[model samples]
Target chain A: MSTVKQAGGRPRESRVDHALAEAVRALLSEHGYASLTVDAVAARAGVSKAAIYRRYATKEEMTFAVLVHDLREEPPADTGSLRGDLTALAARIGDQIGRSAADVMTGLLADVRADAALGARFAATYLAVERSVIATLLDRAVTRGELPERPDSPVVHALLLGPLFTWPIVLGEDPDRIPKLAPVVARIVADALIAGALPPAAQDGLSGGS
Target chain B: MSTVKQAGGRPRESRVDHALAEAVRALLSEHGYASLTVDAVAARAGVSKAAIYRRYATKEEMTFAVLVHDLREEPPADTGSLRGDLTALAARIGDQIGRSAADVMTGLLADVRADAALGARFAATYLAVERSVIATLLDRAVTRGELPERPDSPVVHALLLGPLFTWPIVLGEDPDRIPKLAPVVARIVADALIAGALPPAAQDGLSGGS
Candidate 1:
């Protein structure tokens, strides 16, 4: 998406991009992901099929972009403490859960299981934002002497988000339960960090050979 | 499925069930979940299609049963200490992961997102077994003065099995990494327990009203 046009003296591309994104959300809200189509998006946005194709090659990519577009704007507020940052970020994640997005995530995660390319895109597009934010917070925590060092990222991700993601799905809670449960999970994570329960330096080549 | 037959003079149903389970595993490995069919399973097992139909109502149900069939035989070992028990349980979860099962779980979980019936069955059939074992461990830990009280179960489940499930998928690690990474996660959960990082009661109606 580009800058504001006319009053701000920006390009026409801005309006088209906004319409495209708005269309995606409206259609997603109206009909679930399964029924969403590029033609419908083009018709709804009044943006040409050619323009939509120019931006995203497939319906899936278009949907992914729109779904996570909010991450570009809103980040957890800098609350000036490690616990506050962690809790804020966790709460940010919790707030993201709504009926429609949750439905979409379930289907998306299933596809991600076997598709490495899509998984990488998801990492780069969606997860990387959180990763960068979390890294900033953790590094700041180290600077402030809250932690001796940043704990491992995988475990950090797990503690920060694992419960929020798995709680309702695995435990039979209402899908809406994510918003309520997030704070409790965040507290558990903050406590884990305080107790030195996190390991330093996340490893990719996990485990020693037996 | 019934008891062992012939040699022990138990019911004949046991052999049919055994053959059916074996066939399911073999087919799942051979063709993957998408291609796995009741017709193929019956043929492979030399069990009649009628027998298979009598047992499972659909392809999804049959697959779910075969995939989780191992849980019926193996509960996580009781290692006599809270940390040990948590680690042991986590390790058991890790060991269950494999290529075929992971593929199937991805598909199944996608369906579980929208279908409450499947979700409840999953909790009762699979998660409930782990739940029972974990509850026993937490209660014993209380008796031994290891915890103030049993920690909130949703958070406990997240710490125990979250990273193992999410690490490979979310972080782009090999699906095979689960077996190795499981121990490390187990250690984290145990340390969280020692540090009192877990909460005492998991609420379904979570969060203070905003």
Candidate 2:
């Protein structure tokens, strides 16, 4: 008896994945997070729902895939100086925010709130990638003796992203403000790095000394 | 025919308002942002939907009211020194996180992501209150000469909350880790304030001399 061999290799079309990702990105930009739907993505991509499902198990997974694909893998070029490296990194981040990334972020945040599991997954995948990139940059600075060899690198990383996230999203500042703020932030980071690297006793006297 | 006016100037019921606010907090804790609903809030509050509508007009308003009611009105008590004041503030924030405040924050962030207008409202009501409180503490530090006046006061305020918001929520670290990190963060703020307050040439040489 000849058994029908089920074709288990290379089962899906790569085009479908690309289309779905694009569709999800478009929908995220247009509708923000609250109104995004799997059905809408499938329709926008002009692909069968079955095809989309074969790739992604849920809307959350699909949305996450798009973000993963979009997030840059490495920090911008080093430029041999901390200020230049940070300036480039800040500018790239600012560009992303101007591209309606705020809408995508809002959607992802909403998903995390709705489902605890999704929140964990989102953090593990998207946030971890961005943070690791920043950490690597700071590590480079430490190796070059540009920053102190303290345990506060993580705190500095948070300071960089926190204002970027909070000002527009929470404080309702115009996106145009980021360009001006980027240099100011770079200066603050420079000062903090310089001061943090100093010896404890000597550092204490500087602030209080006439 | 004589028309009679409602008792207590438009017949507002304090009991209904309190119930609605409590219901909102409960929903935030239990269901987070995506699952919370105005209908559910009314049901849980044991009040007519019309009664809730009369007070809030929308779920966003109800959520705002709950956050306003729950937010800490002032920074922790003065400890006579900047470090002591900061330690007390960090501990108070830690307490809030240990309670239901983290859940409320998760829900608020989710709501902001799903709805731009709702996010704006959340920022104005909830985050603004926190910022103002931190600003007050930093202002005290400046007065005590522990912090320099050169760095914008808002920047100093951001330095305090930036780590708290970025690490656990954005980076998804354990909330319990905040207090452990607070002292290092305080040091950075202190250093930044000192460096910024110095004259330009002195500021440039402060980090290099050490």
Candidate 3:
């Protein structure tokens, strides 16, 4: 636990983590999440199974670390306007939806449904982290008076992200088209948030609807 | 090919088709799509694989028939008001997102990505059918003056459906909660369609953004 002792070990530990992450990504792209095993990852990464086990208790956890944690940790955008920030964020997301992204997600989600513990872990780790990032962006917009107070964060998050996520995967559109869709996506979100445009019924029912 | 001969044979043929469809649903629920085989479906339905093959060319085609064609053929909602129609439609869709729904969709989509022919068939059959239904609803709204002319159908589709599709599967939320979310979902779509609210830049760019 000593600082000097930890300094030498920390670098090696993180290096192993990186290798394991890379291994997971490679396996996911190649054979998908269902076929990805810890032993295979260890063999691929040139690390021992113990190294992967020490970090993650299950394949789901490993997937969370690689797909959600490492890949989604970019610095939050600040282009002085919410529109610019959202457009940048959208483009970044669109770029990340590589050809194999759908395969990996489809595989991961199938497993998540079958395992309750993994589902909870995903909600806690992946969903929570992603939601927090969006929350931070929305908070900045509110502070700038560019968005109304108490915008329905969950609704906003879903609307902004759902289309981008669905376009390539479910609709089978080109992933490259996401950048072109970004401006429109951003506009839709901004309009919903800024204008009190909820239908009469939902306006009363939802906190963010108004 | 005679009318009397066809009448004598049609009932039995339809009966076999129903059995095959039922068997496919059972297998999909029990073992998922990846593990499901033509042989297993044949055995479960007590029909020959050749009989299945006679009607459908492949397992993907059979899956498309049962999951997409049969289950999705509800009469279009005609609740007078677009809000009423959307609310009813949302609730119906929300109800249908039971536990097996995601698993089935995940499996179908994975297969769709792997097989080019299957993917093309899906776009032609399932995706085309769903889009036309939404388009009809939107057209009704436009006719009613509840929405503007020439709304971007695909964007509107994504926005309205993205949340409903995503919340239960990705976020691991309760499927039942989608009904509660429907009114809000409907309002968001309706607002985006009616008000022409758009971010300044995208307003100038997109057709309906302004």
Give the alpha carbon lDDT tens digit for every residue of B1-210 in model 2.
Answer: 000111343324656666777787788777665577888998898988877676554565566555533333567787777667766765665445434454456555555555667766656655667667766776687788876543443444455556666666665666665665566556655655555533332233321232
User: Pairs clashing in candidate 2?
Assistant: A106-B113
Q: Which candidate leads the pack in TM-score?
A: 1
What tens digits encode model 1's per-residue C-alpha lDDT throughout B8-123?
42457778878988898888778766677889999999988988887665566677666643235444566788878777777666665444455576676666655667766666
A60-99 per-residue lDDT for model 2 (tens digits): 7677556533333567877787777777776666555545
Error of 3 at B209 (Å): 20
TM-score of each candidate's B chain against the true B chain: 0.80, 0.65, 0.77
RMSD of every candidate to native, in Å, equals: 4.6, 9.9, 6.2
Identify the superior model by TM-score, candidate 2 or candidate 3: 3
Residue-level lDDT of model 3, residues B62-156, one tens digit each, is: 77666655324443667776667666766655555543466566666667766667777767766676677776777787788776564655566
How many residue pairs clash in each candidate at the backbone level? 0, 1, 0
Ranking by TM-score: 1, 3, 2
Q: Where is model 1 more than 4 Å wrong at Cα?
A: A1-18, A29-31, A69-75, A98-102, A202-210, B1-15, B69-75, B98-102, B193-199, B202-210
Top-scoring candidate (DockQ): 1
